[model samples]
Target: MWTTTPHIAALSVPTTDPSNTKCYTTKHLITGNRTSTQSEQQLPTYSNASQRSILLATARVIIFNPDNGLQATLNALIDQGSEATIVSEHVVQSLHLTRTSIAGVGQGLSLADPQYYRPKRVDLIIGVDLMAQIILPGIKVGAPNEPIAQNTQLGWILSGRTQPPREATHVVCHQAVLDTESLLKQFCEVESVPERRLNTAEDVWCETFFQQTHKRQPTGRYMVRLPLKTIFDPSMTLGKSHQIALNRYLQLERRLTKTPEAWQRYSDGIKEYFKLNQLAPATTSERQSTTVSDSQHHCSSCVLPHHAVYKEESLSTKLRIVFDASANTSNGRSLNDILCVGPTLQNDMSAVILNWRQYRYAFTADIQRMYRCIDVHPEDSEYQRI
Candidate 1:
């Protein structure tokens, strides 16, 4: 038999025998504008095919108010089938909920995997939209009887079939239907034309900086200075990063020990950097020099730290060395914070594709080591130090 929970706004499937008198909860939920045609018809009925229980994916999460920093812990159900994450009304009543402008940027309250929504009794179903943003590429598999563990930004989630309770009798049949209306709406939004906007003051400054400082070498390669703000001196603001880099390197070494192939690739990539003159060893004077005016703490010129980002699907490079330009310094400001982000230089993908069809022959290619090809000016090389 099929029944609806008015409060949760989800369809629940029950056993065929009424005497069983037991029901199991599931993460799959459908919520959106239901068409009149769909609403008018009687809800379709479903029955358990067999008396077998299925395991549902679930995790414990903590929710917090971004404004006051108030925290609450709750149980959450991870549902890849659902379109949107949902919270019970009870959660809103308990905490001061406010709408945030940042969406898909991981700044919104619901986007945080570590802490999400809902109460103890009610489960917060985390849908595909938010799940895709916070998920990291890490997974662990164990023996047949053991639950598989999947690593996420929130933490490790253990999920798989477990032994059912002795008293449990009713079996569960799961079904997650895609909302046609929501899919159609998303399709329309993707096809819609984006509005053009003017560049901000910072963008204008970045443009001016590029035009004034950029140079071309005899080999036809372009060199540019880092777009640093005039207000703060980087040498003074940035703290010593030797210890931080050492700790990160040690952790990476431990992880790489398990995968010799990955370790070899990482070593080869670093060697290429030095061979191309993109990286070099610090001079004796450069290493010893640590002078800052009006600063109690010793600040280093080379304060950048980096980590390895593994992408098995990448065709060219599997392991990428991503420098942490956004790492906070002693004053809580970062290299990214002091730099001006320029306006996007490329046209929209829609415009590019539209023009592509006009050509007699269409060819697709991507630049190899695109960023590494460009050189930083000698004066600004210190800021680019890793």
Candidate 2:
């Protein structure tokens, strides 16, 4: 086997042509004291400490060279901006070099600097001029062994210039949470209605809500139930059936006198009349012979004899007469000024005379306090109060 030996030599300065000078130039020396070699050795060019630091710290820098031209400068800027140094076709052509696979032709001008040397593992590249234009001042850069420079550049480009740092807050209140809690407490503290009333109220509220929400008016009539006991009574004046008929007649009279149009429609197809019938009263011998069954049936019966005195006119004729009487009583008078007539002979005579002109000739005597003239017990006059 052949033996290998190292060569060593003194450092020497590199030579430069004066005609190629474009910017400031510097001389560098290279030394190989560790190894011995017969061939000439290459030396590293010396750079200014301040200048090197400036270049390293600069996020963006512009360079102009006579020999390299603007295209080369643009390429160099793009290479500095990008993670990987790129060589363009135009750059190679300007430098009088042949096209190589290592270089790629990219569309649109980029900020990558072609002069900046980058490792093969780098995935992205950009230019210093582009970075200076895009990146905000708030971002941190140049950390040792940090891979976030690319991320920082991206953030700066998207977010624009960063703002100055804000002072820290000493105290803070959870206003949103406090407000939410207050509202919830108020809602929980509200009293709830009983289930039955709640359901009714909810139905009414929903009906109202629908009406208001849809801008529709409510429609339908309200009905009220009247007690028959409040109108008719068991008294000596008339039979129960007669009292019932009279009560109905008075009710119709009130309705027609108060609201003629509404009453007219209500009574349009109805009929009214009086019928007479006869029955025998229970005698003492009959009562003594009456069994418990007969007593059970007759206990609530009246003692008066039921006799057929007169068969009144047809229901249609009675209604017509009643309507005519109401009209006559209401003539030349407003609804508010009209007086109510009771079921008395004097009132009935007046109504009959007012209704029939032929009856005006009968008994032309004027009596004061005609209603007061009739003696009525305090309890019996309750029905007439209305």
Candidate 3:
């Protein structure tokens, strides 16, 4: 059953860290109270307050501890006042850490006097982004009809908040891939794209997200459908079958005569294409039937559904072909209805762009007529007849 309501889906992509990224994983042992620990497992530490914030940091936190790392209990609290993770000055100085800078996010570094003795207290303040990363037993981090923003609003209203110590300094930490609600909102809504360019927008968004979240280079053999042999092997326009001859194209010349201004350059382009490769005439009268049985057959014929749109100043022109591969000739199926479209595998464009940025220079090329260059297998030519 289907409903008319539009369904929304969100995928929270996990960030990948660098090989050298300083991070650690620690799990809490069930220990009662600060004094009641009888087992070897370390009990999960809590802030001075008993109740946890809506945005709670659980599991092992990957932190930057300057002095060979230290074991301490960090607090998790919900803060409606600020989106950044806030830490005390003592934690900053004790660790003597040089933090990474996140541009455009508010002033995150704030200083405050230590009010109470807490373990590993101030080196890093884990808030919303970091909290969302951790998944606890009872609560589903990502749930139905649950907006994190709404949760933060309701979280602050319902949960207890640990007040920052007096004279506390506020600092918003930044790394390339740390997940945040603001980042998601900004990525999806800020840019306005035309309806025709929605795919382009999606491509750009994926690329940005990949750059932000991933650090290490990808390693492993890619199981791409295109084989090394096929890619490296030059495409052939002519197979062994000398029986078939390349069809001569006159439509472009006919169209060019009507528009004399763009005729010379466009004509030259047409000639060059003819010399370089072979394209069979769609209306070739040699009348062939490669169509599967029980289908109406269509003869190749020429019609004025295509054009050579050109620029008057430069005489640059692009020839367009309008294909009616699905037309019902006495048979029911079309060329498109029978031929295989093959696989649809595309690399993450964003990841490609991200890796390109590491180099001092970058370049791109758009090869035209790529499909026509690939030679179909000799045996398969019959099925491919168009």
Candidate 4:
């Protein structure tokens, strides 16, 4: 028997006499006595799944009113893509929603594609209604020769948005929703060593190691070991250095117990130490190095020395370039010549390099590292140099 309420739907199967009315709600009559309920509050109230399906299947052509705010127009497109609604920037601003700037101008473009164009900052909103008017206005359906191409437009669809409707105003089960539910259930069922057990084992290991070496009193209850080197040499094992760090951390944790603020400082210090040495926690996907080889390199003509190098290296090693202090100037020379060898080296060097690439071609002629080496020239000095 299936029963539905405004807040819940209940399904039950009788185990006793099939025709008995009293056995319907009786807990003992059902196997496992399970009652399943579907709640109106839990289910979406969209007109129907079919309507949503139609909306997703139908390609929308948006016509922008340039006279209106450009940001509003872009926001409408983004909102529609994500939430299945079209909205304008003015509406977003009026609602006072937070807006983030687009990181780059051209978002969906291949490195080799010449026709790729990136837009300036585009505002995003959630919901189909927000973009419906922008992309599927009555005028767009009548115009056939417009520049819109389905391939390019489809890529503009944001992945983060809700699953598209199969049809407008109708509801249908989406494969994505089913897959996501299965994944969540699988995750919940997975079992691993509990954090408490791991922490206890680590504590025991440190305690035994410390007692064997240091004759001093082991007064602290908790212990932590900090690695000295970022990269652990295969031949090397935990030695006196590790023991000493463990003792220091235990002592610090003990001393800071009285002051909450000092405890935070101690915790921060430990994290910073690990981060600086690159000996932090390990993630599920271990860090790997990847490299690629190519015969040709392309340089951007818009900016001086804006080029990428083609190199052959192991797939495990990643290839990146970093500019040195010399290339960090306003000088007109291309900074592309300066390259750092590895990821760690690039990150460390980036802090020292001040000058950066600009959009204008004229700015590319400025001396590199102009900030560090060049000084403001006096009238007399300028005339003498000239």
Best by lDDT: 1
| Candidate 2, run of 10 with poorest lDDT | 2-11
RMSD of each: 30.6, 47.8, 31.4, 36.1
TM-score quality measure for candidate 3? 0.27
TM-scores, one per candidate: 0.47, 0.13, 0.27, 0.13
How many clashes in candidate 3?
A: 20
User: Could you arrange the candidates by lDDT from highest to lowest?
Assistant: 1, 3, 2, 4
What residue pairs are clashing in model 1? 62-115
How many Å off is the CA of 181 in candidate 3? 9.5
* Selected candidate, larger lDDT, 3 vs 4: 3
Tens digit per residue, CA lDDT, model 3, 1-386? 21111111001111363222111110100001110755232222233344432222222233457566753444333333445665444455556655554543322222121222233222344456545544333432233322132232213211223333345789999878766998887787645331333345434544444345333224321111111112222221111111111111235456678877667655564455346533222222223322233343232211111224464454323532222223322333333333222322355566567688899999887645433333332222232222
Q: What order do you get sorting by TM-score, best first? A: 1, 3, 2, 4
C-alpha local distance difference test of each model: 0.54, 0.27, 0.32, 0.26
Per-residue lDDT value at 227 in model 4: 17
Poorly placed runs, candidate 4 (over 4 Å): 1-235, 240-243, 264-386
Q: In model 1, where do residues sit more than 4 Å from their true spots?
A: 1-192, 231-236, 284-300, 357-361
Clashes of 1: 1
Per-residue lDDT tens digits for candidate 1, residues 177-221, read 999999999999889766556899877877887899878889888
Could you tell me the lDDT of residue 68 within candidate 2?
46
